[model samples]
Structures are given as C-alpha cells and as structure tokens.
Target: MTNEQLQIRVEQISHDFFKKPFIHKAYFNNRLRTTGGRYVLKTHNIEFNPKHYEMYGLDELDGIIKHELCHYHLHIGGRGYKHADADFKNLLRTVGGSRYCRSVKPEPVRTPARYMMLCQNCGMKYMRKRRMDTSKYVCGRCKGPLKLYKMEEANGTQG
Candidate 1:
C-alpha cells in the first residue's frame, strides 16, 4: 500500500483500538531489513517493512502496527515503554497487540555444482554454484580432470 494509505490506516487503528489519535506519520520503509516495524521515539513516526506486507499481508501488517503502537502510546504517555517494562506489557496485552514484531529470515540455499569436469581417469566429483570451465579447473579432492554434470536443484527452502 502507499504511504498515504498506511498513514490513514495507522490513524484509524490508533483511534479505533487505542482510543487515541496518531498525529505522526506512518510509511513503508524498504531499508528495514529485520524488524517488521519500528516507532521512532524522536519523531513519533512509524516505519514498516514493505516485505512484511508483501509476504504476510494485511493481518500481519496490522499486528506489526499494533506492536509499534504499543511503543508509540506508552512513550507518549511518559510511562514504561521499553519491551521489558511493565506498562508496555500491560498495554500490549490490553490492546491484544502482537508480543513481538514478526519478520522471518530467509533461508540460505546450497546448490550442487552443475559444472563439473571429472578426471577422465580418477572418478572425482566437483560441486559449485557457478559453472566452472572444466578445462581451467580440476577436482581439488583428487586433482582429477573435471566433467560437467547435470544441474540439480539446491535445497532452497523458505524459512
């Protein structure tokens, strides 16, 4: 969604759920790599990771907003606002906000070497992510000539 839409949603959620108005800005921040969202204590602005919305949709987005809102409201009230604080916990539970921001880390995939040149003599296998020139490289295990093999899919599973 656009920043305008996010701002409107944040305002609506603050009013509807928190019984307060959110006068600050709420916008998508592509630079947020790990966090689902964050509340700026200095500016009172809320930034959301666009990837979270893209992957998890509005329901997850709303939960993140709720999490950030807990921080926003508590900080504004001059009460305990840190994650470990009593006021923050109480308010979060009362509002049914997410206990933590949800951002899933991507799993790394290991691909078997597709370009292999076997020592025509020594039966050695070569694995590599990139296609290696058989004429230029040899199998380190046996210093045998390498042979290109069929490419296989790596276990690139999502987290």
Candidate 2:
C-alpha cells in the first residue's frame, strides 16, 4: 500500500486502540530490513516495513502498527516507552500489541578450528580458530610443553 494508506491505517489504529491521536506521519519504508515497524524518536514518525505486510498480510501489519503506536503514545506523554519499561509492557499488553517488532536475524555460521595445541607430557589437546604461539602458552592440565598442530579436516584427522 501507499504511504497515504499507511498514514491512515496508523492513525486509525492509534485512535481505536491507543485512544490517542498520532499527529505525526506514517509511511512505508523500504529500507527497513530487520524490523516490521519503528517509531522515530526525532521526527515522531512511524515507519512500517512494506515487506512485512506483503509477506504476513493485514493482521501482522495491524499488530506492527499497534506496537509502534505504544511507543508513540508513551513518548508523547513523557512516559516510559522503551521495551524494558513497565508502562510500555503494560500498554502493549492492554492493546494486545506484538512483543517483538519483527523476527530476529539468523545466527551466523561457525567456522571450523584451524589450529590445535597439544601437551607433550599429558597429551592434553586445545582447539583454536587462529594460529597462536605455542611456546608462550603452557598446557593447563599438566603445565607441560605445548606444541601447535594444524587441523586436517578433509580426511577427518587430527594430529
């Protein structure tokens, strides 16, 4: 939908649920990648992610609007508006708003260990992603001499 539609819907939601008038503008922000909606502190504007509406439909869009409205109303009234604030949480629960604005990003992939340190006396092993000076660090288990070995993952072997 257009920015005008977004503005109208946001205003309606603000009025119906929040019992407050949102004097600021609301728009569809294409640049919003992570959040479904955001309330700008400086401009008092609410920006909605068009992708969220396209993927999740009107119910989700309404929830996003309600969530932002909570921020807008609380901030305008000089009340606690942050996620961790009691006022924000209570108002959000009263209005049945979304707990989170959007989904979280996926966790990054883990890289395999590149180097390992082994103790000469006790045969204790240590794994590391980066190369380190084995001479400087002693084995924790037996305080023995430590030797660094490169991990060979292709053949599933460790030296």
Candidate 3:
C-alpha cells in the first residue's frame, strides 16, 4: 500500500484501538530488513516493512501496527514505553499487539576468499581469507615467489 494509505490506517487504528489520535506520519519502508515495523522516537512516525505484509498477510500486519502503536501512544503520554515496562506490557496485551517485532528470513550468507596468491614459476594458485606474506611463504609445489592478488568472488573472478 501507499504511504497515504498507511497514514490513514495508522490514524484509524489509533483511534479505534487506543482511543487516541495519531498525529504523526506512518509509511512503508522497504529498507526495513528484519523488523515488521518500527516506531521512531524522534519523529513519532511508524514505519512498516511492506515485505512483511506480502509475506505474512493482513492479519500479521495488523498485529505489527498494534505493536508499534503501543510504543507511540505510551511515549507520547510520558508513560514507560519500553518493552520491559509494565505500562507497555499492559497496553500491548490490552490492544492484542505482538509481544515482539516479527523477523523476516534473512538472505543467505556467503564467505568469499578475499585474497589469492599465485606462484610465479608453477602458476599454482592459493585462496585465503586474509592477506598473506608472499615473500616468507613460497609456493610449495615449485618453491617459487608468490604474487598476491585480491579476489572479489569465491567463484573465481579475477581481481
């Protein structure tokens, strides 16, 4: 949904559930990788991850909105808005908000070899996580001087 829709929804939810008006902005933030939603303390704005809605659907988005609203309302009223606080806990339970921010499946991690060393005489290549001292460590195959080069991808792209 658009930022305009998000603002309307947040305002409506605040009024309907919290019995208070939400004056600040609410928008979808695609850059939010982990959390389903976030309540900004400085801006008093609520940012929802649009991917969360696409993945989990409307029900989950509603719960996330409720959760962020708990923080928004409490913080505005000078109440303890932290997750550990009793006020926050009570409000969350009352509004049926999610206890924790929902997390998304993370992208697969890749550990590529950062450094590569080549033997001058034998042309034997070596991969390493860290830069090596080529002068001290000669090629085992040909006992030749090694030339170091950086590798961007572990798939064997030359640097």
Candidate 4:
C-alpha cells in the first residue's frame, strides 16, 4: 500500500487499540532491511518495511502497525516503550501484535571454493576460498607435504 494508506491505517489502529491518536507520520520505508517496523523515538514517527506487507499481506502488516503503535503510544505517554519494558510488552500482548516479524528474504549464497589443497602422501583434499602457502602447512591426516592448486586449474578450465 502507499504511504498515505499506511498512515491512515496506523492512525486508525492507534485509535482503535490504544485509545490514543497517532499524531506523527507513519510510512513505508524500503530501506529497512531486518525489521518489520521501527518507531523513531525523536520524531515519534513509525516506519514500516514495505516488504512485510508485500510478502505476508495485511494481517502481518496490521500486527507490525500495532507493534509500532505500542511503542509510539507508550513513548508519547512518558512510559517505558522499549521491547524489554513491561508496559510495552503488556500493550503489545493486549493488542495481539506479532512478537517478531517473519523473515522476508532468503539466506545468502556462499561463494564457491577458489583453491584446493591436496596431500601428496594420503591423497586427501581440502577446499578453501583463499590461496594458502603450501610450504607453511602440512597435511593433518599424514603430516605429508601439501600442494595448493587453483580450483579452475584443477578442473582443467581456463580462467
């Protein structure tokens, strides 16, 4: 939804749940990466991760809005508003807001091994992402001399 729609929704939820009006702005923040929403302590504004609504739908967005509203209302009322605060926890639980947001992105992919170390004596191989000095290291299994080879070279591929 658009920022204007989000602002209206946040305001409505605030009034419905907290019996308090959210005077500050509430908007979607695309740059928010790890959080569903955040309440700005200084500005009393709430920023939501648009990905939450796009990925999980309105139910999740409502939960996030309620969660942020808990902080907003408590802070505005001069009460404890942090996650660890009892007031915040009670308000959040009362509103049935989500304790935590679900992950919206996948785990990062690991880069392929770029180098390989082979033991001359035991034929054991170890993969590494960086080149190691062969002369300084020995095989763990047989204490044999180790040789480092580029993965592309070992695979017979030209880089």
Per-residue C-alpha lDDT of model 1 across residues 1-159, encoded as one tens digit per residue? 999999999999999999999989999999999899999999999999999899989998998899899999999999999999999998888878888666567888876465534465677655566766688876677777766654543223211
What is the clash count for each candidate, in the order shown?
A: 9, 0, 0, 0
Give candidate 4's error at residue 136 in angstroms: 2.1
lDDT of each: 0.83, 0.87, 0.88, 0.92
TM-score of each: 0.69, 0.70, 0.66, 0.81
Instruction: Kindly list the per-residue Cα lDDT of model 4 for residues 33-110, writing each as its tens digit.
Output: 999999998898999999989999999999999999998888888999999999999999999999999999878899
Among residues 3 or more apart in sequence or in different chains, the pairs in candidate 1 whose N, CA or C atoms overlap within 3 Å are 113-128, 116-147, 116-148, 117-146, 117-147, 118-145, 118-146, 118-147, 119-145
Candidate 2 — worst ten consecutive residues by lDDT sum?
150-159
Error of 3 at 62 (Å): 0.6
lDDT of 2 by residue, 1-159 (tens): 889988898888888988778899999888888999889999999898888888778889998899999999999999999999999999999999888755635578999898878898998888899999987999898899998878874125542
The best-first sequence of candidates by TM-score reads 4, 2, 1, 3
Model 1 misplaced stretches (Cα beyond 4 Å): 111-159
Worst 10 residues of 3 by lDDT: 150-159
- Measured on C-alpha atoms, candidate 4 has an lDDT of 0.92
> What's the lDDT of the predicted structure labeled candidate 3?
0.88
**RMSD of candidate 4 to true structure, Å:** 3.6
lDDT of 3 by residue, 47-150 (tens): 99998888878888889999999999999999999989999999999999888655688677978788889888998999888988888999999899998887
RMSD of each: 7.1, 3.5, 7.1, 3.6
Report how far residue 108 has shifted in candidate 2, in Å: 1.2
